[model samples]
Target: MHYRVAVTGLGIVNPFDGEGEPNSGGVTDFFQRITNGQSAVSLYETQDIPRPISVPAVRCAAFRPELRLGKALSTMMERFAQLGVAAAFDAWQDAGLDKEYCQASGMTEASGVAWGTALGGLMAFERGYRDFWQHGRERVPPMSVVLGMNNAAAGHISIQLGLGNSALTYSVACASAATAIGEAFQHIRNGRAKLMVAGGSDATLAYAVVRAWEALKVLSPGDKATAPQACRPFHPERAGLVLGEGAAALVLEDWDHAVARNARIYAEIAGYGANADHMHLVRPDQNGQVAAMNMALNEAGLSPSELGYVNAHGTATREGDPIEIAALRTVFGRHAEQLAVSATKSAHGHLMGATGAVEALLTVLALHYDTLPPTAHLDRVDASCAGVAHVRGTALRGSKVTSALSNSFAFGGSNAVLAFKAVR
Candidate 1:
């Protein structure tokens, strides 16, 4: 027999707030924060990097600057790792019974960490090169390689929280974090383990990475002084998405297990569907995306019409925004209009691997809060595009959506969809 997964606790470290934000911020809070002038995007300041361009990036949740990061943490990994650890513990404590909730959730002291990332510790890698060319390998830090490994975020969280079950990292292009959340949900639902700290973390606003992204010709080429409509998800002017970083963690618990302890239940993770297009490296395929959504709905024991909102993958890229619309048309058909559709990238920019997890949490919060967050900066909807309203300007209120979907499509044609429902 199969079981369901519930989000009992949430810990988010996004650009909108500090790492310790209560998981209680549902759609309204999230939308309000995004619209209220909170931003993670900024013009980077670094030496030798003149006129350093701005990118949608963040360094959220961490041991405060006073905490003193160790040499073990390359500069890149310091705050980034701290963010994961802090957020993980915050969620652990939030899920009722602190260390006591451990056993109730079926988590052994050996509980694992499911972490995701688009690219891990890019700055650490740069440090190694700077030392290699400038100083020499002899002067390079001994722990540089370890710090830059994709698993750094997970390892740090496991060590800080002392969760020992199994700790690993997923690096699936952009879908990495969403995949991590889904896999962790599967682990708890299948009785593989008790509690899992799953989400994504990344800090890629360095000189080297930004310049390379500039070469992609997908980023905004216009003005940096003005925010160039920070991430225009579905609007025609969307040249490409602004890459951002951060980590969002969710605590998954067994149904009967959580109820016995009188724990707070936010929503149920009824279904998760993941697939790859194999058609192209970066280009998304309609059939694959559509299939993934259908699979998630089927697993959720729901029909297309049941989904009230779709947290779109809407990266705002020319090909991406439209392709996702086509896929939605195939899956939701005429009901697509009724489904409140919004792209969070419009507000916080593209968080990459952590994007899906962050957006998933927002959607789950929406179910609990009975409101839909606005997809800002979406002033005009492409006339011929699928009419999901493209949610723009301001937030919407009063919709009790029992079920919803958050779509994440990553590079390498990776696609993932998560189905969530409000706790009854």
Candidate 2:
């Protein structure tokens, strides 16, 4: 017996209200700011390195985990785990799954957590390196191993939520979160679990991580004045991606379980498709992208024309944007021209492993409210990326979006696509 997955709640800890502000208003406020074209990207500078470095980045500067998770719990986890636990708590509360209720209903053994993080505990490791190499220390902290592990977030979340079923983590670069969510959906759909907390978080603003990305020449260059417009997806003068630090999570429950509990359903996860390019280690393959998308549509029992919107994995890189558009053209054919597509990364910046979860949340909200967020800073669409109906400048409201796809294509040839249908 196949089960259906329902997204009952959402949470985020991003720079959605622009830089330096806490996301106090939660997901609704995030949707409002992003759809209004408010960018969180800003000029980031740090003198921690030998030489001063400046670049555009989105940082959740005001995210205080202590205030949300308490001081004792906050101090035990690294930045990524802190962000992940806070977001998970928010999602749990949003789903109406409090500790008392979970204990009363005997949900401990049926619930689980699946999280993603590309650079897990990067900040802690960086700090350890600074202490050892820069300060000439003999050894690092003993707890560094537990705090710096990739599965730390999932482990903490499972413990906090009393989830005894599973605690899985994925580190698939940019598609990590989407893969986690997709796998969790599969687990629930196959009757392996009844409830799952699925999402990702990354806090990789460390000096070394920034320098490594800088070495790739893909970090968008900008000054204070141009920082807000640095990431222009599908634009003629699009530079490249802006790195970000954030977390996002969703509570996915079995459809029947959600209904029985009177939980509010935002959208139904129709299908998830995951595949590999097997063509390049860095460069994306259009054929692979097309196949991944087709697999999702097939699993969802949806025609190409039925997909009303697409949350594109647009990194604003010259080669990547055009190839993604080409794949969409091939998959949707003439209907590609009618598909409402936008890359919300333009406003929130790219959160690496956490980006897929952020974009997935935005896609769910778009379908829930029938409003499509726009690609900020897109003054003129690039000639090669002009085939689709781009949502730009401001949010497109009342489009009656019924079904949508969230695309997350990562390096190393990993591609994951999720299909969502609005609950009528």
Candidate 3:
């Protein structure tokens, strides 16, 4: 936790005007919208099964669902594979790493990738499945299985980035990306690698998947009529969350290496912690979430009051949102009220595996701009978020955020809390 790692450049291929804009759509835009009392969830007319929150899902700010990977990777899984590759390239450029060869050198077999995906290659598999049923093995596509592996996103990232070190994909429901980042941070901090491209990508808006969520009774039902009223995190009338797609990448550098190259520093990786509750799969657990947050705080040698803002894991679900706030209160106590909290999920829907890094990037920016992002659809506090300053409707200015925490709680009780600070 003492070692210093700075975030130099950032690259995002998210939905809402993704990379640069008055409000980059993807996750940040998602959060900002919810904070502004709006919802990106519209009527997804393409798959009209009814329901309002069933709007067209978050398309990548960078790629259309039909976007091809161009040259080498024309495989059926190219959509996901391409997004992961493009996001990595964006991070490289953002970090000012030379495409000719800002080159990642000496990457070992143990070099880390950590691609986070809750659902992998559903789009490809969906078509593949039908083809298999219709055309039989003659046209099943030789790479069907490979593309469908839950680890395809991470594996493709390694191959594209030339990551000779370590490669692994996490499928821990929604908290996948956050877990990956925590691991990537550990690798660099421990002298395992010089830099790591860490993040997640999800392209699973297939009919079957949506049907699964619908069966679980968590998918938003508020089409255009009251879509904004749908994913209202920490708000009273909030129903549930919308689903989205994105791939936000971050370049994690070794502290010494970053300073040696004179790279622009964004924020320091102060602390990280992850834990599993084993309590329940879908239901929320306040204790496990709080424990992870406390562990990160302790690891950072920070007190609850020192945390200026919290990037809450506000999924806007009936169970998850309030449980997240309860965890905050448990960890911050009386200072919970003083701490500002915002739900990126309120806007972005749930990026599943991408939420952690996406929200972590926003937290770093909050420290940089001194303006905490708001929890868009937060009109009235649910009983759980009653005492906390869940920033809503508008952004707060001149916040002295010396430190902040980004929380990611996923299904199966996977929880991760990352503590960050401005690079002084």
Candidate 3's displacement at residue 424, Å, is 4.4
Instruction: Please give the distance, in angstroms, between residue 127's alpha carbon in candidate 1 and its true position after superposition.
Output: 0.7
Q: lDDT of all the models against the reference?
A: 0.74, 0.92, 0.73
Q: Clashes in model 2: which pairs?
A: none
Q: Against the true structure, whose TM-score is highest?
A: 2
* Top-lDDT candidate index: 2
TM-score of each: 0.89, 0.98, 0.89
Please write out the lDDT profile of model 3 over residues 285-316, one tens digit for every residue.
Answer: 98898889988898788988788999888877
What lDDT tens digits, residue by residue, belong to model 2 across residues 311-389?
A: 9999999999999999999999999999999999999999998999999999999999999999998879999998999
Backbone clashes (count) for model 1: 4
Alpha-carbon shift of residue 175 in model 1 (angstroms): 0.2
All models, RMSD in angstroms: 3.4, 1.3, 3.4
- Candidate order by lDDT, highest to lowest? 2, 1, 3
Find the 10 residues in a row with the least total lDDT in model 2: 16-25
> Residue 51 deviation, candidate 3, in Å?
12
